[model samples]
Structures are given as structure tokens and as C-alpha cells.
Target: MTATAKPLPAGWTIRLHRVHNLTVLTLHDEHGTDREIGFCPLTPDGPQDLTVSALDTIAHPRLREAAQNVVTSFYDRTAAARHHRDAFDRAVPDCRVLLGHLRARLPGCRADLGTDPNELTVTLTLTATTRAAGPLHALLARWPGHTGHGGSLADGIDQDLDSSGALTAALRQDRATEFLIWYRGQC
Candidate 1:
């Protein structure tokens, strides 16, 4: 059976090009130019073919690290891409739990968690907003969870949770003292 070629990693439109009869890795260019990045020489296998694993161990460490960085940077981008899901697999439940606890304290509280994308970048934000005030807003405004007021909602209180430490502090927050010491854990 013939070996089927696997597609290159995301953000990598690269292929093996023939440079002096040697297989060199090249990146795609909009002007149809081959930008040579690294070399992936082949073993003495008749027609001179190289495996994907073999190409990774090329002589150029910079090229290998560069390709790896391209792949690694995409790690977070794909986490929320499947089925249009939001948040990392583990963070989903934590977000839900925090939202639920806030809802219990303030029935009018609501949450929105998802990705914000532009022409070049994407970001994740998990926010909870509530119309209640006086004491409830003060409690959520603690560290880890950023609480704010005076938006379009007038009497609305906005809270955002971004780190696991903030999540843990939010979970343990039970009072609205004048100066409560919130532990953001090691997040």
C-alpha cells in the first residue's frame, strides 16, 4: 500500500523542495515563491524518501524550534474551536460552578464565556454581570475576579474570571468585608 501524506501542522503551509537533489523544507508565499527554511535530507532508500519523524530531527535546531513554536502557539486556539465550544475542557466546569454560585447569591446574575476574534487574533473572556447591588456587587468585586460598575447597565455590576487562582478565590469568597484578604492560590 502507498503511504498517504499527512497534512502539515496548522499555520504551516510547508513542503519538501528539491535543493541540489536534497530535500529542503520550504514555506508557502503569496507570490508563488519558495522560501527555503530548513533541510530534510533523505536516507539511501532507492528514490531517496524521508519520513515525517525523520524530518523533525534535521540539522537545523532553529528551524525545528520555529516549526514547533508555530504548532504550539495554536494549542489554545483549537481548544475552543471544536463544536464552537468555549473554554478549555477542564475550565468549562469550573466556570459553570462559579457562575452557579454567583447566581445563587444574586438571582439576576448571568454569564457569557466565549472567544473574541479579529482579523489576526483571538481571546477568551468569561464574564458575569448582575443587576443587584449594595452588597452582592461588593462581594464579587474582590481579587481574581475583576468587578466593575457604571456601564451601560447603570446599576449593573460586572465581574470577570480569567485565571484558576481567581476562580478559586471566587469560590471561597463568602463575605463583603471592608478589606477581605482573597487568596488567588498559585494560579
Candidate 2:
């Protein structure tokens, strides 16, 4: 028999030959087993075209190039948001330790933090800080992405910051205050 051909996708082969004035094709498996795939009449002046689809070659409908895009896009976005949320969950407790550090390190300081979680996003606020050092005043400085209020500790600032942002600010200020973290059960 002829030498085995190079590797091909399953159920595909380099099989084209003239037989009875027709161009015939075949398929081979790894074991060298093969069978006629199709036969087409040759062009009078040249070889006839043999169109192949994975539908036939692989025995399944070929997927579009973007076939998984919708599912994949949803999975990717959801997974990332879930991971960020889980990370935010884990980060909250760490803020307490940072609070302890800040209170111990900063001068004559008291702190009050508030958290609000509304379905999709968690909002944090530095409701209170007192007698904090001048240098540490900007520790809670709001950046571009955060919503902040301009007021002094006497005014009872209720500035809105992301949880992670507040955590960073709390760490820098070295103050921790108690939070009544019990979530009221769904009504």
C-alpha cells in the first residue's frame, strides 16, 4: 500500500485522485482506515473544485469564529465583577486592623466610618475624624473616582468613597472605629 500521509484533523485526508474521469476524495484515520468521501466529475479543461466543511470532515457543524463570544463575554464580565466583589468582601475586615493601627499611630484621633451596600455597588463614608494630625489630614483625600464632601469634622462629613479607597485611607490614618456590621435580613 502507499506510505501513510502526514497528520490531519480527524476523518480528513489528502485524498484526491482521477478515477473513471472523476475526481474522488477519501478520508483516513490514525489507523490508516479510509473510505471514499465523494466523487465529482472533472472539468473538461482542469480539475473540479472540492468544497469541504468541518460539518463533513469532523462530523459536527463548524462554529462561527465568534460563536462563543456572547457566552464568553458574559462569563468574563461576571467573573471579574464577582472576583472584585469577593476581594472587597475580604478587604472589609482588614480595615478594622488598619483602624487600630491608625488610632494608635495618629495623634488624638477618633473615627467613624459608615458603609452602605445597595445591590451593585458598596458606598463608604468617613463620617467622623477628630484632632487628626495635620500631615494625616490628606490621608482620606478624595481622588478623581471618589465622591467627596468638603467639610470639617464638626460638620460631620458624609463623603462617599469606594470601600477599597476608604480602606486605603483608613490604613494611612491608622484609626479604627466600631462598625455594626449585622445585615438586617431581607424584608
Best by lDDT: 1
Question: Given candidate 1, what's the lDDT at residue 143?
Answer: 47
Q: Report clashes for each candidate as comma-separated counts.
A: 0, 6
Instruction: For residues 18-87, write the lDDT of model 2, one tens digit per residue.
Output: 4555654454444555522444453233334332323223221211112122223334555555664565
TM-score for model 2?
Answer: 0.25
Write the residue-wise lDDT of candidate 1 on 52-96 in tens digits.
333355445544544344333344345435434422333333545
Cα misplacement distance, residue 57 of candidate 2 (Å): 63
Poorest lDDT segment (10 consecutive residues) of candidate 2: 178-187
Instruction: Give per-model TM-scores.
Output: 0.28, 0.25
Most TM-score-accurate candidate: 1
lDDT of each: 0.37, 0.36
Q: Whole-model lDDT for model 2 versus the true structure? A: 0.36
* Runs of candidate 2 exceeding 4 Å displacement: 1-86, 111-113, 117-123, 127-130, 133-135, 141-187
